[model samples]
Target: MTTTTYPVRVDGALDDRLNRWLWLVKWVLVIPHLVVLAFLWIAFAVLSFAAFFAILFTGRYPRSIFDFNVGVLRWTWRVQFYAYGALGTDRYPPFTLYDVPSYPAHLEVEYPRHLSRGLVLVKSWLLAIPHYIVLAFFLGGGTWFATQNWEWSVGLVGLLVLIAAVVLLFTGRYPQPVFDLVLGMDRWALRVAAYAGLMVDQYPPFRLDLGGDDPATTRLERRTPQSLPSASPREPTPRMSAGRIVTLLLGITASLASIVGLAVGGGLAWLDLGMRDSAGYVTTDKVTLRTSGYALASEEVTIHDDGATLLRRLFGDARVRVLADDGLPVFVGIANGADVRAYLAGVAYSTVTSPGPYSTTYDDHAGGAPSTPPTELAIWRTQAVGPGEQTITWPIESGDWTLVVMAPDATAQVAVQADFGATAAALTGVWIAVLAGSGGFLLIGMLAVVLAVVRRPEPGPSTLEPASAGRSNESEDIH
Candidate 1:
């Protein structure tokens, strides 16, 4: 057994002449790649977690899983190289996970045969914390945390690359110094990723091996022969069958759908609670009313039309309750300004008065007709017999209206209360049903995905491949 430097290697050659405008559109051009990578990363996360437990017990990273994960990293590096990582390549990245010899950006990791079971538990998360902290400043941290707020300055590598891109756009050359720095940062990040993924036991170095080639290879003198630890029978690489692919796809789809459902359901539930519990009706501070032979006391009430949905409008209503302490009969009626004015004008001896449109109080109650006639609409009145307490409710509509309270024969003090109901009980049932149904589909999708990832595929003769055959040779060349 021998010791060497880090096993992960990342390399990229800066293209001589980059297109001035291409960098601007590179993000758009790579949308398809980003979409595919999104799903691939999800699979990668699941596989990495699975590999964690496997290594914990068996002391080996599954060779097939290793290759697939490496491919994902490789593919991601190429896209980043072309777009924001290094701006090192103009050639479009290939969609396949297998290496493309012609592609400018490359990444490869030497597979570790026997992993320390004890280290596997902490290295990916705990041991990698320092590297993660450094990479956070370099790469701007993981987008998952960055997305929680508006702070966009997370990725230092991306910012520098953009500067390099601008320099390239104007000067037609990617600065050598900038490119080297970007690569160093990228290399550092990838090294941390590999370590955290359980691909290597050698903790990543704090040093930045800048430029297209790794500098450590020249410094490290001896290389140990890589060997698998004695363990359970090695299984052949599993070929992903069409059925397995479908199952994984179903799982991914369901997981994504469940996220959407949860978000929507949670939002709807919040809205429903707000509507049902909101203060629906507005009440005025008690105003003194003189109850005497048809002496009308008019209090102006204005209702603002909330442009709510038709369903809410259909289920919503407004009610006015008249309360009096004198126990004398009180006549209460609600009408748009015009009808009340007409009715009062016809009464030979009655005094009709109201407050200004914006005024909530009726203090300036002057004699004669109101300066402004209330907008006329339908009118509702309680029986003139004056039941001390009466309530009238009507479908809610927006407008400025007046509440006319009259004492038929006696003088008594009184006040009116308005209550608004904005939601129906039935809607709560509907929302619950929607949440339950969406949640059910989401659970099914998640189950499908977990099963697909946890269950090992069947082995076949065609699935056998020498895992060592594709190990990166760049390290040897660089050394």
Candidate 2:
């Protein structure tokens, strides 16, 4: 047996070079770290949920979780740079799995970008598809499941599974690199986001844990530089990353929620107006009522609240029992049998007083032209009446008398409105169901994408040539 002991150097290396960025990173993250992390994590989480559901519904998008994480990371870094004054300033972007200068004798491994740009963009923008599908199934499905008398449990489970499968499958076509990077961020951030997004799904939490990644493991010992560039390239330019993806999704979701909120609020306001304007009609007789629409009987209506009634009157039936005309009930318009029936149903027609229809033999006054005797014929057509210009003409003789009545027309209009509510609900339900079904099929197509890159794995930088960053492109091309 042999024992070898080396002299211990107890003094810490105070002269060791420090990464200037270390201080910035430490202080920058101390207080605001959680806030940024929370916002970014929530964003990506929502995106993941939406994207997964979208793939399920539409049968489109990349499916690899690693690639998805990468995309999110890239996006988040760019957003951070811009927000933190790094972009358009002299600071590097944050959380970039790419562009993270490799530490000396260290590795910068990343999951590959297997998806195409066209497909990736399409998937990114259409994340709304899943959101809508999820919303529909949640609200509409719940309603249907509750109201219907069918045993929908088994079918529901099958349907939901199908949807999940489709989403996973469809996403396989575009194994986005940006999304992969997001998952590669600090484990804590990734863990929190995962918890929010995959709570109900088969998707698991981050493969790596937070605060577990060591900076020293990836730090590099760069050769002394001749000079640092006076004006550094604009940092945090928009780049693909998992974090960025989350940001985009969050922005979209927030916008969508705002629009929906406005619409619902406006609708509630309208309902309130209708309730406020409600009134019970009071009619005296069967007058030829003219209005915008129909008239309903009280039995057909259910007044939930009280409202005001509008009374519009023309120069007719209103009473004038004052001075000069001595108690005359000014009946100034046409009359009919219904009016008389309402006024005095059983009274004898012959017993009705002075206002009687008279018929006489031909009078030979002024060469056989029959007299222009007063009759109820001309009063059949309703006379026009406006406010002032809206008038009523009496075709009856100067002393002729006719009866009139007051009627209201509000109840009938509500009957026409009754069908609108049920119709809208049915239509909305149908569309939502269709969206959910589509999401399921979409998920089926995403599985292939997941398989493609999930197996590809992240590679070490040992085999990689350093990026054309510090060196000139012309020098490499010439070589």
Candidate 3:
């Protein structure tokens, strides 16, 4: 029987000269790297999603996306090694995504020439569930116990790292055995990350290979009959220029924004299609309004056109419906703001400043009852009066207008259930354009990101030479 080494290689060369107190401040120092890594991780996820489809159809991961993803992993490993994962290095991690050989931490993944079309579908999620469960303990962040009225949660790795930090703080020495164990756990996590990220087809082994140097790179050569000596270290992978990094980040940000836009546009389109009545009106849920005043009036509203003809095309007639709570003949009317105010002047009424079932507010006026009945007033541009329900329809024109609701008999204590509706005939087209435009920008963003992060092919003896050049030498192992 034979065994193969894992393709993911995580290395931490503990710094010879250590800073005792630096580990404490490394958390604050790594803030910039953490911030950058946050965005990079988001981009990594987006690119990985793209890779999943590529592998499914082409049976191979896209090389450009692969390099970018590997770079992100490399960047993360260095930060972990410096800050908390192992505290193996004192050197500040570089901001770039490329590997830094002098930085005491390294990570590399072998580019797979072929991938299982079927495996790509489940490897990142379903197949990785067991590893995820184990990782939940190793790197679970922590557990929360809420019923006890207090919280207690800490991951095994975090606990180990804290102990290591305390020991180093007191003795000025990082315990070698603790370092080895932490390294092993970190290695296991990286391998699982690679596998679950859909970067490899091989399932991660349950075994933990503990040490600063990977056991696969060293001990396997001496112990296994089929193993070969480790190859000479290769040159560092080319670093993405600062400009390219900026471009990639911007692209990812744009793509994320575009996704939000798509969601909003889709929601709008869905509502436009699903909520409209036969008359092309979208109505709000009716709410009850009660006031011990002679009339119920809406706050004066002013609509401006600004000569934007699109507004006129986008909106149609507005409708207001009022149903009397006590079966009294109700009057609902739309009129100029001044006219309604003048008609209701010297009369006790309530101005509905805000209207909702739970958050309704009003400006109450103290005066005598109306001098004349609302049904006899000619101020209303459009009015409806009936026993059970009254609905008024007014063309949505640009002007100061107000809606007045009252009993036709000029009595106080007006109580009615009211609803507002609008014929937004152009909404469907507007949302459709939004969806289409967002999709277009999403493509542009993805393209920009790919171009920014993808390793460009260099002139070499063979086209495959570039792939080999970029391949991590640490990945070499007996199959």
How high is the CA lDDT of each candidate model? 0.64, 0.29, 0.79
Ranking by lDDT: 3, 1, 2
How many clashes (backbone N, Cα, C below 3 Å) per candidate? 4, 76, 0
lDDT of 3 by residue, 65-116 (tens): 8877877898899899988888888877887766554678877777688999
- lDDT by residue (269-367, candidate 2, tens digit) is 344333221221111211121112221111111112221111112111222111112221112223443433333233211211221123212111111
| Candidate that would win on TM-score | 3
lDDT of 1 by residue, 132-214 (tens): 88988998843436346544555889889889888887888888999999999999988888888888899998988889876
| Global Cα RMSD, each model | 11.4, 23.6, 6.7
Best candidate, lDDT: 3
lDDT of 1 at 168: 82
Worst 10 residues of 2 by lDDT: 5-14
What lDDT score is found at residue 154 in candidate 1?
54
